[model samples]
Target: MKKTLLSLLAVVTCAYSAPALASGGTEAPPHVHWEFSGPFGTYDRAALQRGLKIYREVCSSCHAVKHLAFRNLTDLGYNEEQVKAIAAEYTVTDGPDEDGEMFERPARPSDRFPSPYPNENAAKAANGVAPPDLSLIVKARHHGANHVFGILTGYEEAPEDHPLADGQHWNKYMPGHVIAMAKPLSNGQVTYEDGTIETVEQYAQDVAQFLAWASEPDLEARKRFGISALIFLAVFAGVMYRLKKAVWKDVH
Candidate 1:
């Protein structure tokens, strides 16, 4: 019995420690309060807009939100003309013409965000590893928003014991404590028109929120529907109870 208990303890320890070990003793991401967290939460339009700016100015050079369409900007409070203007900024490759030749055209609201590179090989050649698409990144990563925020702000000097290669960077939240991407955000890197403080932490937080919204654009609607359903159920339950009392009162 003692041996069996010891075996169970070993298994639990291994299961708990394996992730840390795999990540080279990387620390867990810190919790961040998000506007869209609770059941009554909704995406902040201002923050989403700011995040869009960051992605366009900084992240768009490498990463693409391929799963998102220009039309989807409406969810961020952009109007029809505004969305069209934004879409026009990008060039998209379209279908073959009558002569069997693909043509380039200004992107429309229906078009997906184009990748920076023409192909995977080009992206890999440029960045070593092709940057992952940001469309579903929030849903893809564990503790999505917080993890992303941690990574963006986690860069620091490596300890004497841990050396890094030429292209590698040290990040407190990164697995293995080594990352290929350098610190991307800097103080005052992007100017904000809304008079929001322009800092690395603020940028990280805004972009994380934006990515979260992107991952689940219907989050607000879904929550609203759920709340309505619950209310309806409660009302129906109450009405049914009263009707039962009325119908069975005489018999009882």
Candidate 2:
């Protein structure tokens, strides 16, 4: 009878603990297939360009890619002249003048991408929480692309019993299913010159990829080099094996 009671108590404890375990903390974001996921993977230049557009039109208002330079856009298949033209679009504040006052000037190719807000306080004042700098966000987060992708698409209605704080929205993938930022994308949010569908999912995927590239700009080149080195090692090993066989043939 005691064993039966203990077993019943254990089952009830597990039943109660299951929901708590599932929803108690920041949930792992859903996995999504990425073109740049594997050793041989490469970034899609077209997608990066599209993602840049989305970032400029939507995310730039809040989040900032402060470390990525305008010149880095060249990795997205942009030429020098095009990069210069793109860089000219944004103005960033420069050093103090003769009067000891800071001045603003047009951004140059060499300049780091400017933050949307001048400082952390300003960013926080504008949006309750200061938006995170996205420069190394991909590297900073585990399963970075998937996490960002999931967050972008995870906003949804909370269950009836789930309570949310004021100014917070429900995001199943976020910690406690609560987030300060609202859904930032919707259908037809951004029009693609290439005529790709303007969808939240598409935007999330593209921008996530762009962020990945920003985090590891040379990932493709590095992967290529790694592949070349592996090929050379295999060929060298075969040659060495054959040479050994030849050298030992007489002894055998």
Candidate 3:
């Protein structure tokens, strides 16, 4: 009877834990699986710059990463002076000028990243849906990199029984399946300084990595932490081994 009761308790525990794992119940397409690993690889500075250019020119039209300020560019491979110069290239609003009218001036590091629209209603009016904020998207979503890359590259025309009508697409399992965003990448779309062909697949992968980098700017710090942890474990093991040898010497 005790063994049967223990088995029942184990089953109940599993049932309770299942909900926690499935918290982000949002469904994705069939070509992907929910995972936590980010874009675990290195990126070339030139490719990253090109990807940023693509983002600023194309994707920025619909999405925004409000947490990122213009000054944040310094964190990415660039030097501080270069970051300031880049910021100066953009105009931002300041208080009234001598004429008592709001005026624009070169962007400052302290300024927040600008949004495509002034507010939610304006954004919805233009796109028919609210563009999701991308501040922590890479960290929040499952299979983040693969999901981002897959969605960017997996866009296709509608299929029979698709949730969206004819000419509208529905991936096998996406929420509405009919994502409003259209495919933005094309072969040789924006020629890269590195001479890498700008294919849709490459664009997707590079942009996904760039987004992952943005989400966790302290990635190098995490790498340092791992190295420290490994050293500590090795020293701990050595001390334990020496103590065991000393203690068992009398037994032998």
Candidate 4:
């Protein structure tokens, strides 16, 4: 009787834990205010630059911003020479000699950011799952900048009732409360030349803003255009209303 009761209790425990793990039950990411949050908002150039530094020194090992070009760094306040210097730091495969074999050379301003792995298979082999390209990540996620920030800083110890498998980590904001990628940021992980705070929260905020700019470099311009169009339409409507009154007054 005792053995049968122990087996039943074990089965009950597994059954109870299975649903919680499978359901994900992730908490909503905390809200974070951003310079680029509203229609009149614009990207903070200094923050974007700092975020780029973080990406280069840390995130680049596993993630790629394949849609971004070295030349595009100019939008974040880097000059042409600085952009060239940054591009030359990386090597890219290019060209076919007379033998028609691919050759490797320093990256050019025109080249898109290269992937750390040669191909998807290699990336998956190295990491279990391929890290998504970060170029459009801010726009792609539901909460945009806040979501990125949450993931970067959300690492925490698992609850006593919840145990993680090998290679899995607990993230407060991750769906299912588990993530494959370890916490990517730590306090003072990247130095900032501009004297910005070097805490993990600061890094997460700066990188989140940088990803926002990457996802929408023209956000300010688009907002300007939209505002201009709205103003034009409002004025046009007023003028048309006056004309209608002038024209119909005589008829009445």
User: Tens digit of lDDT per residue, candidate 2, span 1-252?
Assistant: 999999999999999878658667666888888889889888989999999999999999999998899999999999999999988999988889999999989899999888899899999898788989887888987668898898999998988898877778999787577888989999998999998998999999999999999899989889999999999999999999999999999999
Error of 1 at 202 (Å): 0.9
Q: All candidates' TM-scores?
A: 0.91, 0.87, 0.76, 0.88
Give me the overall lDDT of model 4.
0.90
TM-score winner among the candidates?
1
lDDT of 2 at 36: 90
Question: What TM-score number comes out for model 3?
Answer: 0.76
Q: Candidate 3 — which residues are off by over 4 angstroms?
A: 1-44, 96-102, 163-173, 247-252
lDDT per residue (tens digit) for residues 54-109 in model 4: 99999999999999999999999999999999999999999797899999999999
Candidate 3 lDDT over residue span 1-252, tens digit each: 999999999999999867445543435533432222334434455555665776776778888878888677766677878777777877778888888999888887778667778799888777777777766777876656667776777666676564564334544233445766666677778667777777887777667666776787677667667778999999999999999999999998
Per-residue alpha-carbon lDDT of candidate 1 for residues 1-252, written as tens digits (9 for 90 to 100): 999999999999999878768877678888998999999999999999999999999998988888989999999999999999999999999989999999999999999989998988898788877888899999998679998899999999999998988878989998878888888999999999999999999999999998998899999999999999999999999999999999999999
Q: Tell me the alpha-carbon RMSD of every candidate.
A: 2.7, 6.3, 4.7, 10.0
Q: 2 or 3: which has the higher TM-score?
A: 2
Best-matching candidate per lDDT: 1
- C-alpha lDDT of candidate 3 relative to the true structure: 0.69
